[model samples]
Target chain A: MLLNVQNLQAQVEETEKQILKGLNLEVKPGEVHAIMGPNGAGKSTLASVLAGREDYEVTDGSVDFDGEDLLDMDPEERARKGLFLAFQYPVEIPGVSNKLFMQTAVNAMREERGLPELDMFDFDEYAKEKIELLDMRADLLERSVNVGFSGGEKKRNDIFQMALLEPKLCIMDETDSGLDIDALRLVANGVNTLKNDQRSFIIVTHYQRLLDYIKPDHVHVLYNGRIVKSGGFELALELEENGYDEIIKQHQDA
Target chain B: MAKKLSPVAQKARDFYLHEAGKLGDASSGVLKQVRDQAQEAFAEQAFPTAKDEDWQYTKLTGFVQNHFAAVQTSEEVAGKINAYMPSFPVIKLVFVDGNFSESLSDDLNELPDGISLESFADTLSMNNELDKVFAGQDKILAEPFGSLNSMLMRDGFCLQVSANKALELPLYVLHVQTKAGSISSLRNRVVVGENSEITLVERYVSAHEEGAACSNIVTEIDVAKHARVKQVIVQQQNDSSYYFNNQFISQADSSNFNTFFASTGSDTSRHQNHLYMNGEHIENTQNSACIARQSQTVDSRSYTEHNDEHGFSRQLHKFVLDDKAVGVFNGMIRVDQKAQKTDGQMDNKNLILSNTAKMDAKPQLEIYADDVLCSHGSATGQIDENQIFYLQARGINKAAAMQMITKAFLLEPVEDINNADIRKWITDQLEVALAKTHLPKA
Candidate 1:
């Protein structure tokens, strides 16, 4: 298994409001999974916890990634360890040029793998290839990171960043929310290109339309902070047509 | 018995008293009255001790005791421009010991038609109408240092540009204090004609190696209808010097005024900038950044007044305090009753780089107009740890990560500089200042 979460239980600060209650999940290499849910189902909280956001406390859990204690690492450490999260709201870091930021992140990941750093010229040459692959404008690299970018552009930028980092497991949290039709198509195409036997993705989304562009092997219905049912990709088609009411009702009855 | 003055202040006082004999007779009755009143104020206020509020952060006891006198009018410091010239192309004017040095200044023989650059004393003597320009404004001279500069008023530059004339190069005023133990006060008056545009760069530097030196300087800018003026004041005095300066600007109808201040030196420094928008549709943008290290301290106070309707003003100031250094900022924006439809914004951000470093930022807004947008905020905090961690995770070591974060903190305001050349120059200076902090490299 590439990632193993065993009976994870977590809560927010100073309250018994359990966001993740005894959740269990496992994903192996070369597999894609989709987590679908209604509002207040702890979808974002789960993603944030996995990414090591300090606010989420994993009260009782064991997360093992590639034989290492994943919860013991820092957020950046998790990133260096091939855990990539495309934030729902991409952070805006002004004064840091996109090109420089990407190069720094790439070099950091390479350094973790005991590789040499890329000089300015080499980094520029390398970034150009990825920029073109994503069909992103070359001029965007020179501007501040995500500053003054449109919603569609920010999403594209995030995907481009994911491509540059080349992580083993990419967790895209609501990456399709603000994208237009064309932008959504482009983002999906980029993700499709990055898909391979050596990597996997956990795409979290609200609408089933995004799943149409990039199909997932497993679909899990999350309701009230727990997984109510699990099925194949066709389950997404069923949920899209009928909505999430039947799944919630069946889980409550059980 | 004579009050025992510090060796430096004593020499400074002697120098100024000697130079006073050479000054031309007070040109106008108003000038004489103003000068006498200034002398009285200085004698009464004297040099502030540690108790005064304005002088609390910056101690001037040693500077006062030095009693340095003023420099003679004819004294000149040669060959000082080569090392300290601004990185940008500018019309250079050199002043030594508060007196304009024509030989060291750029050529003005073939004037640019309507533009004028001459000595204030000469301007007042040649044109009777100029007397009213400097006529005793007691309100402006009420401050102790303001009165001192007015009384000891020596020759300084007077720049006037005609309507619709936009100079290609920025005017650079280089004030060099070469004489040690001499209290030097330089006063400048600039008048931007109706519909004209200009950029001014004022650099304050010291040539003295050591000893006590104090500079009490004041500049008044008159911006007219539809004119735009950008002023940059770069003060890089010697680490051993003392300086107290004030800048007063009044903007008329539809004019825009932009001011940038960068201070990196001086043991103790105080800078005051007051902007008044007296006509409709006027706008002002003020920016300031200071890097204080070791025992140095910088105190900046600013006031923006909206006296007319439909005016706007925005102010942003940032400080990076390291070592035991202290930085203080007091900014106020006032909207009068008739100043309806006004918009004002003020923000001050401080980055404390050391445990011992201290910063005090107070932003105040008093709005009487009902239909106005006014906001003021002040924040003081250490470097963001998350930002630091993000950089470090990207292969930058802890030290380089901190440097990058600090640079980003200042760059927030530095990037607001409109001119490309000025922006680049300020960035380069910031790099040098960062280097001087002896921050460990990543």
Candidate 2:
């Protein structure tokens, strides 16, 4: 298994809010799993926890990524270990160029994997290939990170970064939110281009529209901090036809 | 007003009184008079206490008590300072212990036409311009240190660029301090005539490791009508030395003046800039970057006065203070009543790397002209934890992430420099400073 999460329980830092309660999940290599739910169903919290966001405290859980404990690591450590989270709200860091940020990040991963660091000229060439593949603006590499970028550009930039990192497992939190149809298609295309048998993906979203572009092998219904229902791709269509109310009620009654 | 001088001020007075005859030359007649008047003013006033409004944050009790001796710079000390020179190619004029060094300097014959670079006394004999520069400057005698500098400065340089001529290369004045506990006073002047353009760099390098020595330098720059001048002041003394500087800048009609002050050393370094927009449509930009660590203190104060119509000035200051260091910035923009359509702004940003570090910032704008548009703002805080997380999330270690953020924060001030070499030099300086500091994980 690429990722195995057993009996996961988590809460917000410095608060009594339990965001996730006894959630269990599993993903093997090359499997694309779509986690869909209504509002406040811990969809984003699960992503944050996996990415090692400091505010999300794991009370009880064991997250095994490629036979290593994941919860005990820092965000950077998780990233170096090939776990990537495309944030829902990408931060705007002024005075920092996107190229420099990516170089620092990529070389870090390279160093851990015993790969030689890229010099400035070589790094620029490396970034250029990914930049062209994503069809991002040439000027985007020179601009400060997400500063003065439009909502769509910021989302596209996040996908651009994900493509460059080439992580083993990618967790995208609400990647479809706040994006137009064109932007939505671009993001799906980016994911499709980078997909391979050795990598895996877990997509978190509230709508089923995104599922039309990039097909998910398995669809799971997340309700009230638990995976209430799990099925094949047909589950996303079923939830689209009938709202989350009926499905969540079924789990509540059970 | 009759008042007994404080012991510090008394020492300062006597020191100048003793050095007056040795410092004066026959051609510097007006400068002698100015020095005499400044000494009289110093006798009536005393060294300011910590309670004084302008000197409230920085404690100078220890500095005020100790007597700093003035010494003649030796060739051995000048040789040691040559290793710290900037890598850029320029006509270098090196000063050792406030005295101009002829043996360790480049040939002055290399200067272009319409430009005259020589010792201070030589320029004094050339013209009566010193009288005009100090005509009404005595009114500023209230500043104790400025008055003291005017009274005791023995040797420096005079650079004059005549009207309608532009220099092809930047002129560098590097001051090297080698004597411990010895005070060095210098008076340097630059005159850029109408339609002339030039760039100058004034820097100080000290060899003292833990000495109580001080370097007091005063530079008077006069930008004539329609002239353009760029000045870069770099102070990278060792941590144990003291540097007190007062820069006097005046811009005539339609002239443009630029100043870049980079301070990365000294135990107690204080820089005061006085910019006067004396004519209409003048442009003034002054930017200061202070990177201090350990127990050092860096104080930056400025008063930009827009006295004419259509004047514009932008003041920016960036400070990164760590350890138990303290950073201070106090800036004021004043628009006179008749100065209509004036636009000015002041910005101060500080990054405190540790909880023990402190930053004091005060940005004020006094606009008497209703038509003027002026703004001022200051922010003092440590690195944002969210920003750190954002960097760290990308696989950069915490300490390296903090360094990146601090570098970017400090780079904004030097980004607009027209000289790429100087900009690169400043970036390298910031990197060197970062290596010595360890930013605690946020």
Candidate 3:
């Protein structure tokens, strides 16, 4: 298994309100798991907690990623250790170029993996290859990071970053939220192109529309901070046709 | 009856009366008259106190209480300072202890036709242009340090570019301090004729780090019609030095002026820049980036006056304060009634890196014309935690992330520089400053 979580309980920082309650999950290598839920569910909170965001406090539970404690690392450390989170909203850094930002990130991950850092010339060529692979505009590397970019472009940029990093486990938190149909396809294509036997994905979304483009091996209904129901790809189709009201109601009644 | 002077002012007066003759060639010519008049004015005004509105934020008690004297520079100290200067490919004029060093400076004959660069004494002997530069300096000379500088200033350069001539190379003026408890005063005048262009870089550095010293400077620049000028001033003195400067810029019709000032080291300093738009269709740009750490205090003020029509101006100033350091910015844009169709914008941003750091900013726009467009704003805050987290999530460590963010913030003002080499040089200087900066993580 690439990631395993047992009896997970977490809350918003400095608050009594629990966001994640006894959430249990298991993901083997190369499998895509789709987490579908309604508003106020723990879908995003789970993503944030897994990424080691300080805003969320993991009150209980153990998360083991490839035999190592996942919660013991900083956000950057987790990133260096082959964990990637595509932010829902990419930040705009006015003066830092996209190339510089990605180069620093890539070099950091490489250093942790005991690989030599790429110099400027070599890194530019490397980034250019990834840009072409993702079919992104070449000028995107020259412009400031995410500054003045369209919503779709931002999502595509995040996906392009993920493609560059090539993490083993990717947790995408609503990557399709502000994207148009074409951007949705580009993001899906970027993910589909990068998937391999050793890579896994945990996709968190409010709507199942994104799951249609990037097919998931399994689908789970998240309600009241726990995974209440789990099924195969057919579950996503059923949720799309009926919506989360049915699953949420069934979980509440049970 | 002459007003009683403060102890600091009295020290300056006594220095002028007793020691001015040996330090400068100001015994004869126009410099003599200017010094005499400035001495009278300086004796009447005391150092600025906290009660003064302009000096409210920056405390100068320590600077005023200490006695700084004029000292002679030895040959060994001059050699040490000469070694400290950079070997940039430019027409360099070196000044050690406020006196021009013939051995260290480049040959003035290297300058092309229509361009003339001369020392203060040489220019005083040739023409009365120094009189015109000091015509309206009485108001400034009535102030405490302003008058003191005028009375004691002896050695600096006078640069003149004739009509239709452009200098192919940038001019560098390097001021180096070596003696402790010394006061170095300098006055420079720059005049660019119609349709001429020039780029000037003025840098201040210190070779002595153990003792306290002071540098008082006055510079006047006149831009003729259809002329252009770009000036960059970098101040990297020791932590024990005091720096006070005044720049008077006057622009004519269709002229352009751009200036960038960066100060990274000083115990206490004030850089005052005033712009006078005397003609229509003028363009003026001013930007500054300053870093203060420890108990350092940096005060910067820019006052631009649009007296004619069709003038445009923009100013962006940034500051990074750490430890108990303090930063102050006072910017004002005044558009007169006759100055119709003027456009101006001013913004000041402060990034405080410690809980004890403080920033005081006052940006004002006073426009009497109805058709002009003007806006001014100021923001002071700590590093954004979200920005930090965003970078950290991207695999960048917190320290590197903070540095990248801070550099981007400070370099935005100088992004429009056209010369890539000069821009990179300035960027390198800022990088060195960042290495010494105290950047606390959020």
lDDT of each: 0.80, 0.85, 0.86
Poorest lDDT segment (10 consecutive residues) of candidate 2 chain B: B19-28
Model 2, B25-144: lDDT tens digits are 543478667777777776665466676788887767656665676787454764475576778787888887777888778888778888988977455556667777566455457677
Q: Chain B TM-score in candidate 1, rounded to 2 decimals?
A: 0.91
In Å, residue B23's CA in model 3 sits off its true spot by 8.4
**Per-residue alpha-carbon lDDT of candidate 2 for residues A126-212, written as tens digits (9 for 90 to 100):** 999998988878888899999999887888888888887889999989999999999999999999998999889999999999899
TM-score (C-alpha, index-matched) for candidate 2: 0.93
Q: Where does candidate 2 chain A have its weakest 10-residue lDDT segment?
A: A245-254
User: If both were scored by lDDT, which would come out higher, candidate 1 or candidate 3?
Assistant: 3
Tell me how large the interface RMSD of candidate 1 is. 3.5
Best by the TM-score measure:
3
Regions of model 1 farther than 4 Å from truth: A1-29, A33-83, A106-143, A146-156, A171-190, A202-254, B1-31, B47-65, B73-80, B120-130, B207-212, B390-401, B438-440
In order, the TM-score of chain B in each prediction is 0.91, 0.93, 0.93
List CA RMSD, all candidates. Answer: 5.8, 2.7, 2.7
Residue B217 accuracy (lDDT) in model 3: 88
Could you tell me the fnat of model 1? 0.18
